[model samples]
Target: MRMLRYCSLLALVAALAACSSVPGGGPVSQTKGEYKVGNPYKVAGKVYVPKADPHYVAEGMASWYGPKFHGRKTANGETFNMNALTAAHTTLPMPSYVRVTNLENGRNLILKVNDRGPFVGDRLIDVSRRSAQLLGFEKQGVTRVRVEAVPGPNARPATVFARNTPAPATSPVEQKKAPIVVASARPAPVFTPEPAKKDEVVVQPLEAEPDSPATASENIYVQIGAFSDKLRAKMVADDIRHVGQTLLELVDINGQKLYRVRIGPLPSKARADETLGRALAWGHNTARIVLD
Candidate 1:
């Protein structure tokens, strides 16, 4: 009788473990499928990001990402742990909080925006697997969402005042607008670059001697703006020249006139990086490290 009772207890424990939720933890993760979906932010041309806006709402597609980017670091220095409740937005002040609601089901979840993106059309929000699951989109991967900026303590504080409440009206014009379509959800290829051709030669060089001091190499040149008009290119060139004791070079690429803005002919890549960092730290995203 003692042996039989022990076996029964063991079976019960195994059954309970089989029913667990998170990937290896429970059956829900396995039954629902892994999170390998990617949400890319699609932006057309350039965008003007506002400093701070209290209320912002965008009616567009929502998507999720998971698995592949699991341990990678985000642009804001946070780990991309897909299991966690987090998200990515094009621009919302790094680490700002948001509330995402599934318009269809009315399900809601809050997430921290640590990275930037979702460059597709007017799509507003990009969420993680856990957040997506909680918002009730686990199976579908992507869903129609209404994303709203959740006010934080540091945000502007004001009082609520009553205004003329407009009645909810369903007009033919409103109904005629086509519904936003959420694309297929899948993980984005982050580390992968363009593939090499079959005839491409692979060079394996001996490692540099550890004791030898590193020598200075070629200067990295990044082109800020390449324009057809030579005069317009000079205008941007003049704006960035004084920032760093940097020089600007104008070169014609193809047949079009091009103006290339350079940060260095500096002593080394470190000095170049230091100079580049300073410009960006002072709010210069347009400046990029151009490598030949």
Candidate 2:
């Protein structure tokens, strides 16, 4: 993490002054490619408990790392390849697959998360230079993106077919109590890791994605919760709806009107994170900050 921060500062200076080489620039390091799910750690005062959260998904600003740390060792012991479709993340296990969508140009791709970081205030995954190019955000320095975990190689049927990020997270405890209403398109029950194979962790090489782009997205909206019932959505909206422009938006999906409690357009990623964390404290664990 310290190395990441040092490289970041150098990268900034290089960009501002257009210098070819900067003295005391971070050293180009080697990659460590091993598979690992490290212990919970702190970066810049934020605690990130690394776990194989199969349901992990997030949306926030994304930045790229290249050149200076081009050959550095990643968290998993893999050699960092700035040209490869690789990425660094905060909490995802090393060598995992994740689908990252660039909200700016609507370009998306599957990247291998093999390191930890972009550790810069609420920024999500830190893509390699090649990934940023493929996702159409290389020249921009940063862009809003949505990233969701994907099944790694040799994954079981349950893992491969698990619900995507859009689905809400409802545990059995919440289901029996029914304290919160859910969308009609309810996803399969929350995926609990099998107790027998709990320690299993696997990964595979990623195939390069095609250069297909969708329509571009705009603005940042922190969606706190979604529900088929307007009243239930409103109840959540009233509970943790303090920051930004908190409102209950009605969005139509598959012939149904789902009430979405959201706060946006957030001015920056830090603001979005604040809104998201507040919502989580109110029990909206599925709250996500998105660009759309």
Clashes of each: 16, 12
Give a tens-digit lDDT track for model 2, residues 17-82.
865343223222224355667899997888999888778888999999999988877887777878
Task: Give the TM-score comparing model 1 with the true structure, all chains together.
Answer: 0.37
RMSD of each: 22.9, 20.9
Q: Which stretches of candidate 1 lie over 4 Å from their true place?
A: 1-50, 153-292
Compare the candidates by TM-score and give the number of the best one: 2
Task: Assess candidate 2 and give its TM-score to the true structure.
Answer: 0.43
Report every candidate's CA lDDT.
0.50, 0.61
lDDT tens readout by residue for model 1, 1-292: 9999999999999988877533333112211223222233335774636233447667778988889788887755667867666788776655655666677665555566676677776667788886675566778978898766765312221111001212225532243322212123223212222332332211112112221222454345332433445455455455555434444444433332333445544555555544443343222324444443
